[model samples]
Structure formats: structure tokens, C-alpha cells
Target: MAKITAAEVNKLRKSTGAGMMDCKNALVEADGDFDKAVEILRKKGQKVAAKRADRESSEGAVIAKVNDSNAKGVIVSLNCETDFVAKNEKFVELANDIAELALNCNSKEELLDAELNGLKVSEKLIEQTGVIGEKIEIGDFRTLEAPFVGSYIHAGNKIATLVGLSAQVEGAETAAKDVAMQAAAMNPVALDEAGVDQETIDKEIEIAKDQLRAEGKPEEMLENIAKGKLKRFFKDNTLVNQDFIKDSKQSVAQYVKSVNKDLTIVGFERVALS
Candidate 1:
């Protein structure tokens, strides 16, 4: 067996972006060979990750990253079995790192396969399971690259929202962010009343009619009353129909129209714990 020195471990750590202890262990296992140590750590991390695959990961952090130009962004949910492990500094760091990669990569599969400090991301997560002492998994990875994109993460680190806007305004980024925050808070299901599915509307109308009948309302007026209630339901659940959080006097659609006639919300994503 070859001796592994502190300098060799430090060199490997610098090369791999791995923890000090991990680098040292890899160096020992590789008999002081730098290239061989890298391979050893990569394989070990994967094996460790697999061993903890069945562990439940209910708690974790949701992280989002936007480019300096605000043209591209990524959101990711990294999960762990315990809230205690989810709150760990290392776990948060890993989440952020994966989010950054998600922004650069096109798909979740690509992001998972991407290299992280030399080892594949999935392998790194597995490797982390050994150190973190919990089952860690990448829950969700979503990337949005649009003309205008913004994101918001609620205070608890559990909820995250991303919004994409299409507009011809100079400071659209700020507006988009505000909209994203609204989505995070209010959780609108669709961009407008028209965007809500007809089936859902029909179901809601049926429910309203049932409630009205239970209250002994006149059967003749039930359909009319249900229709009226459906309008309010659309107002509550649609992004454009809902009142703007900043100003209750006007709906979000009206607010957007006031700012720019051409401004339109393309899409949005909201993520929270199950």
C-alpha cells in the first residue's frame, strides 16, 4: 500500500471540489494516485447514494437562480428525509449548486447526468447521503429560458414560484418578479378566465348548484345563481382575473393593461411541499 500525504489530499480536494475528509479517504483508497482517487470517489459516492435510495425525503429546500441579464432561470427542489438534514448548510449548498446546473441544462435528465465537481450529480447526491446521514434526492428541476423571467422563494424555503412574461416594456423584469411573488402567495391556477378548463368550470357549477339546493334555494334560479358563482370562482383562481395584490381596486389583467397594452403573462410555475 502506498502512503497518502496531506498535500495529495489537498490537491485532490482542490481538483474535485469535494470535502476535505472525502478527498483524504479517496486519496487513501487510491494509494495516493490523483486520477485514481477521482475515480474512487465517484464510484463510492454512487454506491453510497444507492444504498440510501429507499429513505423517505419529505423535507428539503427549493432554490432558484436567475442569470445576471435575467433572461434565464432555474428552480429546483432538493429533498431529504428529515427537516433537520434539510436545514443543514451543506444540503442547502448542494441544492443551490444543482439549481445552477439546471439553469444551464435543458432537461432534468441532462441536469442529473451533468458533472458536479467531477462526479455526476446523481452520484454526488448519493455520496452526500453518506455524509449527511439521510436519503437525499433531487425532487424537481425546472428551467425557464424566456424573453423575460422572474422567480420568488417564500420565507420558509419550502415554496418557490417562477413566472414568464411577454412584454414590450423597458423594466419588465420588476413587473415579472411582482407577478411571480403574487403567484407564490395566491397560487393562481390559470392566466385568465378563458384559460381555466371548461370541465373544471362545469364541475364548479355543479358543486355550487348542489350547495344552493342544500340551502333550500328556488330550483328555478339555481342555474342562474350557479353561473354567477362561477364568475367569482374564475376571479379568485385566474391570475388576470384576480385583484392585484399591490392594489385591490383593479384586477391583475386590468393592471397589466394599464401598464402596457401588449404585456401578457405567458406562463408560471409554483412548487410547494406535498
Candidate 2:
């Protein structure tokens, strides 16, 4: 075995972000070869990742990123086993990196396989799992694209949202972000009544009818009353129809229109980490 100097160990530590002791052990195992030592550390991470595969990673960072043109956006969550790891600066930075990369990835599988900082994103996650001694993985991921896009990340990185606009009109950024914040706060089930699935609509109508029947309404009145109640449900549950959180007098659609008469909401996505 080659002599492993303290300087060699520190070099490995600096490169891999491993602890001094772990770096030293890796150097010893690799006979003081820097590249070999780095590989050894990563293999250790893979083993740790395998062992923790079943652990629930409920805590981590939620990040939202938009493209340079503001024509696209993505929200991504990096999951870990504890809040301690979630709050780590490095962990948050990794989440931000992933979110930036995710702005181009259309699916979770692509994001995991995409190269990041010379390492596959999956490999990086495995490496961090070993270093942090906890499970680490990518959780929620969503992408939205339109003529204009805006994003919001709630305080504490607990929630992230993206909203797309039909046109890139004046004040579109603030309007889109306002709606994105509303999404992070309200969590509408769909962008509009049209977006709600027929099954969900039927279920809501049936539920309303049941409630009205229990209230002693005549059977003949049940259909119309239930229809009216279903409209209320849409107003409360859909994004555009819902009252603007900032000004309840106007709906979200109205608020965006107020920003620019030509601007319209195209789509939206929200990811939450509880």
C-alpha cells in the first residue's frame, strides 16, 4: 500500500465533500490514488443508498425555476429522511440545481438520468445519501410552458408553483406570479371547470344531490339545486373561477385580465412538501 498523506486525504475530502475520516479511509483503500479514492467513496454511497431504499424521504427542499425567456418553468423537490438534511445549504443548493435542470426535462426519469456537474443526477443523489447517512431522492416534479411563465416558492420551501400565460403581455410576470402564489396557497384541483374530469364532476354532483335530499328538498328540485351547488363547487375548487386570494371580489381569471386585458392563464402546476 502506498503512503497516504494527510494532504492527500484533504484533497479527496475537498473534491468529494466527504468527511475527513471517510476520505482518509477511502484514500487508504485506494492506495492514495485520488481518482480511485473518489470512486471508493461513491461506491460506499451506492451501498448506503441501496440499504435505505425503503426509507421514506418526506423532508427536503422544494424549488421552482423558470427559463431565461420566462416561457417555461419547473418545480422540483429533493427528498431526504430528515429536516436537518433538508435545511443544509448544500442540500438546498442541490435542489436548486435539479430544479434548474428540470426546467428542460419533461419527465422525472429524464431528470434523474440527466448529467449534472459531471455526474448523473441519480449518482449525485446516491452520493449524497452516503454522505448524509440518509435516504435521498427526487420527489415531485412538474413542468409548464407557454408564452409567459411565472413561479413562486413559498416560505420555508414547503410549496412551489408555476403558472403559464396565454400571452406575454405587460405585467404578465407579476400577474402570473400572483396566480402561482395563489396556487401554492389555495391548491386548486384544476385550472378551470373544463379541466376537472367528468368523473370528479359526476362525483361532486352526486354528493350535492345526496346532501339536498337529506335537507328535505323535493325530489323534483334535487337536480336543479344540485346543479347550482356544483357550480359553487367549481367556483371554490377550480383555479380561474376561484376568488382571487388577494382581492376576493375578483376571480383569479378576472385578476389576470385586470393586469392585461389580453393576458389569459394557460396552465399551472403546484408541488407541496409537507
For each predicted model, how many residue pairs clash, with residues at least 3 apart or on different chains?
Answer: 1, 0
Give candidate 2 regions above 4 Å deviation: 1-3
Please give each candidate's TM-score. 0.85, 0.95
Error of 2 at 142 (Å): 1.2
Query: For model 2, where is the 10-residue window of minimal lDDT?
Result: 9-18
Q: In candidate 1, what are the lDDT values of residues 166-221, reduced to their tens digit?
A: 75376577778788888888988787877889899989999999999999999999
For this target, which candidate reaches the highest TM-score against the unseen true structure? 2
Model 1 TM:
0.85
Candidate 2's residue-wise lDDT over 232-262, tens digit each? 9999999999999999999999999899887
Top candidate when judged by lDDT against the true structure: 2
